[model samples]
Target: MDDEAVIPISALQHYLYCPRQCALIHIEQLWAESQHTAEGRLLHDKADKPKMERRKGVRTVTAMPLAQPQLGITGVADVVEFHTGEDGVEHPYPVEYKRGRPKAYQADEVQLCAQALCLEHMLSCQIPEGALYYGETRRRTVVPFDTALRALTCETISATRAMTVSGRTPSATYSAKLCYNCSLFDLCQPRLLHRGESVQHWLHAQLKGE
Candidate 1:
């Protein structure tokens, strides 16, 4: 109500995938899932359990709380590891748990960056990099927090907050690419919608033809 936007960190991933999809889920609170999403749900459920462990002067925690008050976004990370650097200062490293292998999208990186930003804002620390752990491959990929990623993190945060403040969901744009394994495929009817046709009217017309 204060005209300040409070967006969730996940919106950054949605926005990267599709603006309309992002708005639908975030602003309209609409969601329809498929097998892929279900699997992801289970994977996150397994990873989100809070655990406190120690290794070599570092403490690791799961389902760690994070926030960037200036950005007005709050969320939790899969794992937040703390280590003492050579200077004897405690540093935080965020490791994101993924259900699948590497994706060809900035969406994952954006999410990780958001978490890092939150840590930076909250702890007043300089987190130059983080790592991603992929469940499928059982590997860790390190991501550098360079100028490019930082800029994207800042930009996505701005866009997501702007979207939430308006409180209007984005309209679905017809894209055949979005149909693969999409539970909303039938509801969305990307095939017909992409052709600039309405499935309801087309079906009605077909019935008359019969």
Candidate 2:
């Protein structure tokens, strides 16, 4: 919660999905791997290792470290492709790996844009776009670093930083689809927590009543 604390770039995506989930992981340091997370881990295994390759005027770098101090974000990009133009200029394009199909939200894109922001800072060039590679479809979806998405990504970063400073894990709000898919569902106990208690608290109360 220090004023100078650097938020993990991953927290941006997490916060976009669910602020409570973000706080639970980053602020509370709680983690549990569910099937979904396990699959994601596997998918990222190749990208997690740093490597580089060159082909046909394009250079690819995997597991590239990225950080933007102005935005207070630091993380690694899954892959970054540098394309050479006829003008002999090279453009850096980031590619993010996802374990599942694209979500109905902007979480994935924002994360990719954050990587581009880092590239811009490090390379001193404008990164106009990036891509998201989904595991399920095995296809790359191009994402433009448009004004709207850029603004939203910045807002999410500020909001997430504030949440971290507050040092409060938000109370659970249950959604059948979201909560059911969360890896921390058991630890979160969204339904019970929403009722103003947790499973342990309810169990203790029941024992006392006996």
Candidate 3:
């Protein structure tokens, strides 16, 4: 795929969180912001600026553009710290910034792993791990790019790309835990749509009976 056709790395995270959410944003071009999203944007203010600095022996680049055309993925890493090794190789360690603490899902990890994959392809070096820094916790959670995570990232990429190509938005399935806090919850109206489906089905059955 060409550069223009590459999928955004963020889409993989959204897909893992909820495929319907991914479809709503990527496929249907819908968006709604909540306090959570606003906070996230504010937290990214520093990382969103492209800059480079060196601390100790580590070279830190913020808002680094990353792309792996082979994987058809592209995105900007919040921070990529390059640590030089004895072999004169600069090992890349990506750090993604988030607004909230760790969640029950692997979406955040998958997003970090996807960044590692892009770096690996671009730098031609193996990345063993990366990290997620949460604003609320003010700490970093290291994530290993193990086989399972790598597989899941690849699967998410494929699924997201396929959904984009198909141009089909998935139906909403309401889950209080997942949907309540979603920035797109009002726009998605999962509960209303799910209820509408039930009513439609009931009406269809009644008509058939008559």
Candidate that scores best on TM-score = 2
Candidate 3 backbone collisions, by pair: none
Q: Which lDDT values do the candidates have, in the order given?
A: 0.79, 0.89, 0.88
Looking at candidate 3, what is the lDDT of residue 154? 92
lDDT score at residue 72, model 1, on the 0-100 scale = 79
RMSD after Cα superposition, model 1: 4.2
Flag regions of model 2 displaced more than 4 Å: 1-4, 194-210
Report the C-alpha lDDT of model 3 over 1-210, residue by residue, as the tens digit: 854457899999899889888988887777888999999999999999999998778999999999888899999999999998888778999999999899988999989999999999998989999999999999999999999999999999999998888776777888998899899886777876653243334346669999
Q: Against the hidden true structure, what lDDT does model 2 obtain?
A: 0.89
Q: What are the runs in model 1 whose C-alpha is more than 4 Å off? A: 1-4, 191-210
In candidate 2, how many Å is residue 172 off? Answer: 0.7
Model 3, residue 193: distance off in Å is 2.1
